[model samples]
Target chain A: MYGTNPFRELEALRREVDRLFEGVASPSKLRSAFLPGRSARSYPLINIQESGDDLTVEALAPGVDPASLEVAIEGGSLVIAGEKPRPAQNVSPEAWHRSERAAGRFLRKIKLSVPVDEENVTADYRNGVLTVKLQKADAAKPRRIAVNVA
Target chain B: MAENTVQKTNGSTAVVATETEATREPERFVTPPVDIYETAEGLTVVADLPGADPSAVDVNVEDSVLTLKAVVPEADESEAAYVEFRLASYFRQFTLGEKIDQERINAEYKNGVLTLLLPFAEKAKPRRITVKAA
Candidate 1:
């Protein structure tokens, strides 16, 4: 669902275009960002949203062990690390009908556009998604300023 | 015995399978990632669907077709200054295999992931027969 905010939609659209061109921009360098297949670093697909004074970072990853899930906010960079166990570990090699979902340990570090207060960060895991909220470190200054001639 | 072809919806690897029934729904849906494997007892399917209220998730089988649908609530992305992933309901379907026991199928949802157990019918289960030497 989209909101009435036109600026945000334009920003989202721009990001989408940039992401699509990434494959051609650097064929060998760009790995999958969200969905994992032959994924090396970009494991969980992430979406960052700025709502009011807080920045919410959402990672769409399911089946990750709650105990193994970890979120660390270091200044403007966020770290998400976790391990997803295989569903049927004991099953023989020949028993698999389909193994489309990815499994194993994953760690992703995202450089945020705005500075955030690490102390005010909160993380929650639900329905296989991880959402982290961080308060902006500095209040955005008002645009207009009066000039005085001495 | 012939086995049903398991067509996969792969948005990750980009080996997209042409789907007819999946796009029939007017509402937008995401094909949640899934892992399916078979053991001696039956088959186990694990799927990832974030933001789905456990009560709103639906799993059903009809006419030998297994469908998994979950109603997901939009997160903070509605008016976000920046966005990467958008929230959407989950929709995926699988045709039941000949060996599956339609009567005893089981389903469970936890932490936005759904696990389905499709046990093989008793007669279709693997069995060993003793040999007699005269």
Candidate 2:
């Protein structure tokens, strides 16, 4: 089953702290930056790395089902959309004090500066992290030249 | 029935009927125990908040939206880290359906649990009427 690790949990906490500080650091700039009608969603923290022949992007999305997620590369943008339904209510009458859990629809888009081979794109969801591997197109691959007149 | 207790870190606690084995297995961050019941007067929601203080909890309902926020007192920032199990502090929000009564919701915090009573509008709750023989 999909799950989250302590490191990922810590990263989530760090991201929240970063967001809080970002909003608090500059009251004026923040107001102008976060105008009404603007997107209130935060993009998932993705770890991108390049290997020999492919680029990988890993997104942390805990408690979200892989089947419910929609990942696509459209016109140089990677879009991930999904919704996490709220847990069923089971509260009793005599209970006191409650803590709210975060649950709702979420969408995240990432722009890829470099063109990748869409046909060979592969994705996997494991341990609450979605990893996408984009292979470079044939033309984009580096050519090996032979030593000639030297 | 006897009460079954699960000892969670950060002073968090969970209790259920001894017959319920769902609470037994190794604790994962699974769903916590809570229940919602509807009555003629309104909707009453009971939540388990172990080790939670009344002064530290906040509950509000507005325009069919219920928000619950609380702080689980942690050691001072300077205090040495002993061991951490679950995330500190708690936050939960629900955009209630139309059946919820926004103006007259009641809440109580005790025994480390939070109970919220959301009274629905007069016409919002279901009503059964007896029809005379035609």
Candidate 3:
């Protein structure tokens, strides 16, 4: 079972009363109005996994060439930067109701708990997928110990 | 075992070929591929949407829910291609927890990648504490 927030619930009752009393009460809009060139921060999407001795970080960067991408590790943070080129289409030069596609520069920064071996890190790009494998530090690896019962 | 023979003549290069299974067909429903990563701040999600411009992409958050929508333009009618792996786009959404700061969420699209920055709410972030002796 779910319950409504008491604050919002009270506000709703107030709005109902205002609507009943006021001759021209306007309902609050639910959707935000579209804005052009709004300030926004850039973040790159990534997939991370820990294998036996490696922490793999994969960032989906299709339409970008590996040569143009730069990957680096500073302190405990991994950074990936690259730019994507737009593709040419053969569509007619006419008006369209909607156009939605994103293209441009992208930068991603990730902090790792376990230190990574920068020298041994490897990155590969194939079929528009970029895969980066970082080898974990020796101290971060798990060790097992046998317990002796007295 | 099948061993095929190849012969070259007249300074012509002979082509050797071996047949293999056809590639997997594209998914019936167009679904974009997404990459998600957890960061110290919060989480980041990247989606692949070729031929999709920023205007065509839509991001919405309502009542702690995040949604992404886009459309993949259809292929040219005149051109013929041997193979294609692209697909259409629709909408994808995620229900977030208190960890996400909805007000500070931001996104950007460039090329074919859509990147979302989800910052963790200050109250929901993890903090380390020192041990005290009694």
Candidate 4:
């Protein structure tokens, strides 16, 4: 009972093979093999910027329907979820020469570093990118204290 | 991610000029993914270039080489707190084939995605041959 199990060793070998292929295999292929239904590792990449009193988050989401996009703030996390429809219509899958783009539902959650005014948040979609503006809370704004000379 | 190799600058003077231009370039750029499909009519190319202004995007085809360039507005770097995505411009190029009708090509950009329709030349399109009874 204390000896090594062959089944366990095979499982470990399979994981090792997966790790080895991860570096060389294309993302689309890896997704199909390992992550069947999960979202792409870092899809719809986002950039967060802060100004004097406002924070902006730009999300790159091309080929997504603006009407299907949903953005919400849950506690300290900003959640973005959307779906990208397939491009081909009336054509068989075998007709595609280069099927590089992936289409499916994706969800990404980002943590905000500063407290924001939930009521003042605004979101705009343009040129396939979604920019969300969140006004910093009063307490989160930087304050200046004057030194007194005695 | 697709590999969009950096353009090489030759000559000492050209290198010096590129050095100055590099300072104005964005820190980095992500290669936008593209999908190329063939249909009965011709070929269709779809590229994703998010955060790029439609007006600033340039698509040019010269000598069978198609180039796509887009400029993303630079944000205030001093205020970047949390950044998962890098802000940078996008550039990509592809070699076209002889079957493509370069003069009759059509393109459209919307919602950050660029679609190029390269119709096949009249001679390249498949035509049904009428079988005559001999």
Using DockQ, give the best candidate's number: 1
Candidate topping TM-score: 1
DockQ-best of 2 and 3? 2
Question: Which wins on TM-score, candidate 3 or candidate 4?
Answer: 4
Cα error, candidate 2, residue A68 (Å): 1.0
* lDDT for B56 (candidate 4): 87
Comparing 1 with 3 on TM-score, the higher-scoring candidate is: 1
Give the per-residue lDDT digits (tens) of candidate 1, residues B25-132.
Answer: 776666776777766677788887777889889998887778889977656546576555667778877767667788898999887679998887898776799899
Docking class of 3: incorrect
Better of 1 and 3 by DockQ: 1
- Each prediction's Cα lDDT score? 0.73, 0.54, 0.57, 0.71
Better of 2 and 4 by lDDT: 4
The DockQ-derived docking category for candidate 4 is acceptable
Off by over 4 Å in 3: A1-42, A89-98, B1-134
Per-model TM against the reference: 0.75, 0.38, 0.40, 0.72
Error of 4 at A130 (Å): 1.3
Q: Name the best candidate (by lDDT).
A: 1
Worst ten in a row by lDDT for model 2 chain A = A29-38
Total residue pair clashes for candidate 2? 15
lDDT, candidate 1, at B25: 72
